[model samples]
Target: MSAEQTQASGVVGVLESVGRKSLGLFEEIGRFFFILHATVYWTFRRPFDGKEWLRQMVRVGVDSLPVVGLTSMFTGMVLALQTYRGFERFHAEGFVASVVSLSLTRELAPVLASLMIAGRVGSSLAAELGTMRVTEQIDALYAMATEPIQYLVVPRVGATTVMLPPLVAIANGLGIFGGYAISVALMGANPVTYWEKTFQYLDLNDVSSGLIKAAVFGLILSVTGCSKGFFTTGGAEGVGRATTSAVVMGSVVILVSDFFLTKILF
Candidate 1:
């Protein structure tokens, strides 16, 4: 082929690839909405399994406590330590408590806790559902006159949505406490001053905003995980891919949505 023709064909190939990928992304987005519709439909029409909802709550919330708590606590400690050093240089050390409290309740707690749950519970949901999809277990449910979306997806999504707010609330407390411990016990800041400073400018709005974000993040994780697993193919390999995708997508959506939620709430 002529050089000019070859270059033209290469350009066309690149454009085609880009177009194909864009189309694929949109197609997947459409599938997500379809799944959402099915879930909503089943949710209102259900026999309503309380056992599954509670089980998933334990799995997504209770099982995740230690990891989320540790992450939030250390984050607060590091934040306090860093801010104390910086603020001390300017003789504004008192603001450290306020900064730590605001930062934790407004941003860090929900984001960090959600990210932890995405890694743990999101992957677990995806892996479990993907395995069922591959092993014909989900199909068997259909064959047995059970609607899989009702039997499976609603409970998970509902439980996560309900539990995440409380989880983030606990995380907020632990994180704030960690900051207090670091400032007062470790660095010898006055305990009374620290507590006062922490709550002085803080109010319900800050904490409530984070909890709202947490609930949204939970919905995102459950929906993403369930969708990925429900549509999984290619056997074990697909299951692994679905699990990884669930975690990655859940984390990314949580972060992206956090920015928008912060703007709206604050």
Candidate 2:
């Protein structure tokens, strides 16, 4: 074949590969939406497993508080320090509280807390379900006429969806306090001024907006993790892959969705 023809063929091959990958990505997205739909449908069905739901709530919510709190506290402190430094140049140090509080309640608290949960809880859920998949436990449930989506996925999705708002709320408070401690105690900003400005620009809408974002993030993480787990193949290697994919996909969705959510909420 002529060199020109060969180069044209290679270019065509590259285009074909790209097309295939793009199709595969869309297929995966479709599957994820289907799984989310199934989970929501199963959630409201009869014969509810309140015990399992509560157990998942404890696992996903209660167990996640420490990491979320630590992350929020440190984030707020660092944000306050940075904002104070910048504002000091303009002699607007008092605005540190407003910035810290607004940033935490409107963006950082929900995003960071959800990312932490995605890393910790999402990976764990994927691993657990992946292990069950490889071990045939999930198949066993099917054999017994039990729907895995209802028995397994619904409780988890419901728990995370219900619990994340409160977690974000707690993280918001901790983050604000962290900023307060840094601005007032460490940076020598006036305590009264800090407290006043912290709430000056903050209102119910800001706090509720963050909580709303957290709820959406919870749905995305749980659904993605569960879908990855449910579709796991191979064996131990597959379980590991699913776990990693869950965290990566969860984090990505959280960030991507955050922008649209913020635009809508704002």
Candidate 3:
């Protein structure tokens, strides 16, 4: 073939491959979303499992507190320090509290906490459920007339949805405290004044918005994790793929949701 013809053919081949891959990705995403919706809908149907939901709440929420606290505290400190430098230059130093509190409560706290939870908890959930599926435990449940959707999946999803807001709120508090501590101890700022500004400028809407984002993030994490696990095949390799996908997709969704929420709310 002539050089020009060969180049054209190669370009066409690349385009075809890209198109196919994109289509496949969309298909997988659609299937996963469908399964997630079904699982959540089934969870709300019929009688509830109070005991199981409580267990999962403890597992997801209570156990996650320490890490969230540490992370948020540090975030708050860094935010304060960073904002101080810029604001001081602009003669807007007094607005530091407003900047720190608003940023954390509206954006950073929910997004960062959700991403952390996705990495730590979502991946674990996918791996655990994928293993159970591979090991025939899901089958055993089915044989015993226990709906896997209700027993195995629903509680986790419900618990995550319930737990994430609280976790985000905790993270926000810690992050603000971190900023406060740093300002007081290192920056020589008055603690009472800093806190007073924070509370004064920070309204219920700020915190409430973060909580709303947290709830959405919780849904994204749990649903994606469970979907990946439910459909996982090919044994260990499949489980690994599911775990990775769960984290990546959960993070992506969180970012996208953040963008939209910011636009709408702000």
Candidate 4:
């Protein structure tokens, strides 16, 4: 074959490969939505498992409180310290509380809380379900005439979705307190001024927005984690891979969706 023809063929091969990958990505997205739909549908169907749902709530929400609290606390403190430095240059150090409060309520609290949950809860769900898949427990459920989506995914996704708003609320309050501790107790900023400024710029909408974002993030992480776990293959290695993928994908989805959520909420 002529060299020109060979080069053209190579270019065509590259295009084909790109097209195939794009198609595969769309196919995966479609599958994810299908699973999400199935899980949601089965969640409200007859024979509801309130006990399992509560169990998942404790696992995903209650167990996640400590890590989320610590993360929000430290984050608020650091945010206050950093913003103070910048505001001090303009003789506006009093605005540090306002900045920290706004930042935490509008963005940091939800994003950080979600990321922590994704790391902790998402990985755990994926690993647990992956183990079940590898051990044939999922298939066993089918053998017993149980739908895995209804039995496993629905409770987890529903519980996480239900619990994340409250968690985010707690994180937001703690984050504000962290800022207050730094600004008033440590930095010697006026306590009344700090507290007053913190509330001055904040309203109900700001707090509600963060909670809304948290709920959405919870759904994303839970669905992604459960999906990864349900589809796991291979063996122990596959479980490990699913766990890692759950965390990575959950985090990515949270970060990406935050922009759009913010825009819409704003």
Candidate 5:
């Protein structure tokens, strides 16, 4: 082939490969959502494992608090600082509290919390289940007259869905406090005025929308992790890949879904 023709063919091949990978990614994402919806449907169908659900709930929600709180605190502080500086230039510094609270309650707190959970809980779920699948424990369960999906997947998904929103709400509160502290102590914001402005601008919709987003994000994490793990083949290498994919895909899904939710809701 001529040199230029060869180069053009190679470039086209590269673009085609990229397109194929992108299509595969979107397909995996679609499957992830479908599995999540199915799991949620199954979760409400029959009696749940109360003890297992309780334990998973505590692990996912209560145990996640410290990390979530720490993340939210710093996020709120940074938001206040950056926003305050911009508003200060316009002599609208008093709007800092409103800005901080509205942003956190509407998006940041829930989205960040969900991403953190996906990194922590989602990876773990994938690894654990992938390990079981590799070790043949999942197969054993299937042979024993036990349903792996019901016992393992359902409780985990149920726990995440039930737990995440409340955790996000808690994160929102902590984030607000963090903003309040930074504004009053560092920025010289008047405490009374700050609270007044925050209250004036805050509404139930902001909080409710954020919580709803949290629930959706939780489902995404749980389902993607579980689906990847459940279908995992090979051995340790496969499990490792699933774990990595779960976290990365779960985070991407959260960000994408967050945008669409925001657009639809607000």
Candidate 6:
């Protein structure tokens, strides 16, 4: 073939590839929404499985407490250390408590806790559902006259959404306490001044905003994880891939939406 013809063909091929990818992405998005819709609709249906929901909540929230706690506490400590160093130059050491408390409740606790949950609980959701998919257990649900979305997805979605707010609340408190500890014990700040400053600038609005963000993040993570797993194909490899995608996609959605949530809330 002529060089010009070959180059033209290459350009057409590239365009075709891009078009296919774009279409696939949109198709996946459609499926994701479908699952989300079905999950939400079935959530209010009769025969509410409190047993399964409580079980999943334990798995998603209680099981993940240590990871979330450590992450939030360290995040608070790091913020305190950095802010103390910087604020010391300006003779604003007292304000370190304010910064730490406000930042944790307003931003760090929810975001960090959600990301950690996505890594731990989200991955498990994807892996568990993906395995059921590949093993044909999901299909078996249909054979048994069960709505998979109701039996499987709703529990996870509900558990995640309901549990995340409380998790963020606890994380915020622990994170603030962490900041206070570091600022007072290590930095030699006045404990009374630090404790007083912590609440001086913080308000209910900041804590409420983070809790709202956490709930939304929980919805996003659970939906993404369930979507990725529910439609998983292949076998063992597909389970692993879905699990990875669940974590990555959930984290990305949480982070990107955080900016918008913060803007709207704060």
The lDDT leader among the candidates is 2
Off by over 4 Å in 5: 1-23, 45-47
**lDDT at position 205, candidate 3:** 88
Residue 107 shift from truth in candidate 6, angstroms = 0.8
lDDT agreement with native, every candidate: 0.91, 0.95, 0.87, 0.92, 0.91, 0.92
Off by over 4 Å in 4: none
Per-residue lDDT tens digits for candidate 2, residues 56-78, read 99999999999999999999999
Candidate 3 lDDT tens digits, 32-105: 67867778678767768899999989989999888887888899999999988888798876778878889999
Model 3 is weakest, by summed lDDT over 10 consecutive residues, at 31-40
Off by over 4 Å in 2: none
lDDT of 5 by residue, 203-234 (tens): 99999999999998898899889988988889
Better structure of 2 and 3 per lDDT: 2
TM-score for candidate 4, residues paired by index: 0.95
Which parts of model 3 have CA positions greater than 4 angstroms off? 1-12
Give the higher-lDDT candidate: 3 or 5.
5
Structural similarity to truth (TM-score) of each candidate? 0.97, 0.97, 0.93, 0.95, 0.91, 0.98
Tens digits of per-residue lDDT for model 6, 144-202: 98999999999999999999999999899889888988988899999998899999988
Model 2 lDDT at residue 77? 99
**Pairs that collide, model 3:** none
By TM-score, the best candidate is 6
Better of 3 and 6 by lDDT: 6
Q: Which residue pairs clash in candidate 5?
A: none
Error of 2 at 203 (Å): 1.6
